[model samples]
Each structure stands twice: as structure tokens, then as C-alpha cells.
Target: MKKLGLILSFAAALLFIACKTNPFTGKQTLALVSNSQIFPMSFQQYNQFLSENKVVKGTAEADMVKRVGQRIAIAAEKYLNANGYQGYLEGYQWDYNLVQDDQVNAWCMPGGKIVVYTGLLPVAQTEAGIAAVMGHEVAHALANHGQQRMSAGMLQQIGAVAGNVIIDDPRTLNAFNQAYGIGTTVGVMLPFSRGHETEADQIGLYLMAIAGYNPDEAANLWLRMKANSGGQEPPEFLSTHPATDSRIANIRKMAPAAKAEAAKFGVTSFK
Candidate 1:
């Protein structure tokens, strides 16, 4: 009983103190690790990653990556300032790089370090396409998805430990692990990850539009991604990202609203 009470108390403390408000959603989010704590580690990892990989420099594609990233960064700051998140980006040192790799991936780290893998360019195909994807990646950083994921993981482990302590028998503890492992992963963690992906998509669309990239092209980029994947994705419930068709549909639905948002900022034209 004492162990369980202690665990509950600790969890309550975590809930109370480890929450940060997301300026975009106007909702509190898991942030047990602050950006001040996460950023230096992220920067170090980013530098190590760049050192290990072939960071393509000075090429047109590389230049486009930096160009799109800078535009998206400015758009993010403008949107945040307009939305009353003044000084939100004070410590963010924005850096962008294109890495030579065959994996179709790009990501933004905490504090605005970004990398675009070469394998993604063929699929991106145009500046608008790059903006669409870059906006999505940047949205991940701005939204603090990495911090949330890490926090959720910590909670999941804590839950497992609490569950183990509550059951004394060896066989019962074994069964608890068996049941809790799959339940927590599928029920809590997977859904949380998927939710972040969807939110990033929506936020990215608006960011791209605000940066003068046609939001309509966001859907078009996903259509190309779907083709590249050849429709062999896991079920939406099992995947961290929505299935391709669903993602494309969601982007299509959000594009008009995204453009409307851009109009508020006097961005009536797109690149």
C-alpha cells in the first residue's frame, strides 16, 4: 500500500509540474524535460549525426533545404508572435542541412536543428513540396513532440514498475508484464505518437501557407509519398503516422483553412 501510494503521489507531482502549454493548441502538454535541458543534448546529437553522415553542401538541393527552412522558421516566429507567444524562440539557433542518404526521412530536432535526407528530394520534387515537408518537420520541433514522447516513455516505465510492485507472486508478476506491456504500448504510446503526427500535419499546412507556399501542394506531396510507398503501410492504428490515403485526405480538408489563415497575415500568394 505504501509503495502504491508513493507511486501515485510521485505521478501526481509529475502531472502537476511537468506540463507545459502548447501555444498552437492552447493545451497543456507533457514536458518533464524542458527545452533548456533537451536542447543542448539535441544539439550535440545533431552535430554528431552530421559528422557521421555526408552533409551535402553548396548544391542547389542543399541550398533549397536551407532556403525553405529559413522561410519556415520566420513563418513560425511570425505566427507565434501574432498568437501572443512573444519571445518563444529566444534560444533557438536554427540550423538546416541536407544529408546524403537513401532513407526518405527528414526531421527537426529540439532548438531548430534540421536535416533533410537526399532520398526525400526525388519525392519532394519542387520547392512547394519541400516546404510542405519542411513545415511538417519544423512543426514537430515547435510543438515539442520529442519532449512529449520522452515524457510518455518515462511514465510508461513508471506504470510498469508500479504494476510489478502491486503484484507479489512471481507468476502473477509475469502475467502482469505480459498484459501491461502490450496494453500500455498499444493503448497509450502508439495513439500518442499518431496524434502528434496528425497535429504536425495540420500545423505544418498552416505554416507552409503562411510562408507563401501553396497549401494545396501539401496534399499533392502526400499523394506522391503514397505512390512511393506503393500502399503497403501498416494499419493506421498500428502505425505512428496515419495511413497514406487518410493523411492525404486530411491534408486536402485542411488546405483551405490553411490558406485562409495565411490571408490573415497578408500572404495572398504562394511560391
Candidate 2:
């Protein structure tokens, strides 16, 4: 009982104090770790990764990546400022790089370090397409998805430990552990990850539109991605990402609204 009380109390304290407001969604999000701690580490790892990888430079494709990233960053700042959250990106040292890798992947670290793989270029195909991809990546950073993931993971681990402490019987404890793993993973963690993906997609669509890239291109880019995948994907519930068709459909549905929002910023034309 004492151990359980301590665990619950700790969790309650975290729930109260270890949260930050998401600027985009205006929702309280777990922030067990602060960006002040996450950023320097992310920046260091980014520099290390760049040192070991072939970072493309002085190329048209590389330039396009940087250009699109800058536009997305600016769009994010504009949105935050207009929503009365100015200076939210003060410590963000935005950097974008194209790496010579054949993986169709891109990511943005906590403090705006971004990488786009060369393999993604074929799928992207145009500046608007790149904007679609970069905008999504940048949204991940702007929304602090990484921090949320880490904080949720910490809570998951704490739950597991609390279970171990409270369950005395060996066989029953073992069963509890197995059931807890599957239940938490499928019912909680996977859904949480999928939600982040969807949120990033929506935020990216608006950012791309505001940056003068056709929000409709986001849907088009996903169509190409779907083709590139050749229909090989796990069940949507079992996967970390939304199914391709569903994602494309969602983007299509959101495109018009994204464009309307962009119009508020005097972005009447899209590339």
C-alpha cells in the first residue's frame, strides 16, 4: 500500500506540474522532460549524425529542402504569433539537411533539426511535394511530439513498475505483465502515436498552404507514397502510422480548409 501510494502520488505530481500547452491545439501536453533539456541533446545528436552521414549540399534538391523548411518554420512562427504565442520558437536553431540515404524517411528533432533522405525526392518530385513532406516534419518539431512520446513512455514504464510492486503472486504477476504489455501497447501507445501522425498531417497542411505551397499537393504526395509502398502495410490498428488511403483521404478533406486559413495571411497563391 505504501509503495502504491508513493507511485500514485508521484504520478499525480507529474500530472500537475509536468505539462506544457501545445500552441497549435491549445491542449495541455505531458512535458516530464523540458525542451531546455531535450534541445541541446537533440542538437548534439544531430551534429553527430551529420558528421557520420553524407549531408548533401550545394545541390538543387538540397537547396529546395532548406527553402521549404524555412518557409514552414516561418509559417509556424506566424501561426503562433497570430494566436498570441509569439517568441515560442526563440531557442529553436532551425536547420535542414538532405542526406544521401535511400530510405523514404524524414524527421525533425526537438529543436528544429531536420533531415530529408534523398530517396524521398523521387516521391516528392516537385517543390510543392517537398513542402508537403517538410511541413509535416516541421510540424512534428513544432508540436513537440518527441517530448510527448518520451513522457508517455516514462508513464508506461512507471505503470509497469507499479504493477510489479503491487502484485505479490508470481504467476499472477507474470500474467499481469503480459496482459499489461499488450493492452497498453495496442490500446494506448499505438493510438497515441497514430494521433500524433494525424495531428502533424493537419498542421503541416495548413503550414504548407500558408507558405505558398498548394495544400492539395499534400494529398497528391501521399498518393505517390501509397504507390511507392506497393500496398505493403500492416493493419491500421497495428501500425504506427495511419493507412495510406486513409491518410490521403484525410489530407484531401483538410486541403480546402487549409487553403482558407492561408488566405487569412494574404497567401492567395500557391506554388
- What local lDDT does model 2 show for residue 23? 88
lDDT of 1: 0.92
lDDT of 2: 0.93
Instruction: List all candidate RMSDs to the true structure.
Output: 0.8, 0.8
Candidate-wise lDDT, in order: 0.92, 0.93
Worst 10 residues of 1 by lDDT: 235-244
Compute the lDDT of residue 82 as modeled in candidate 2.
93
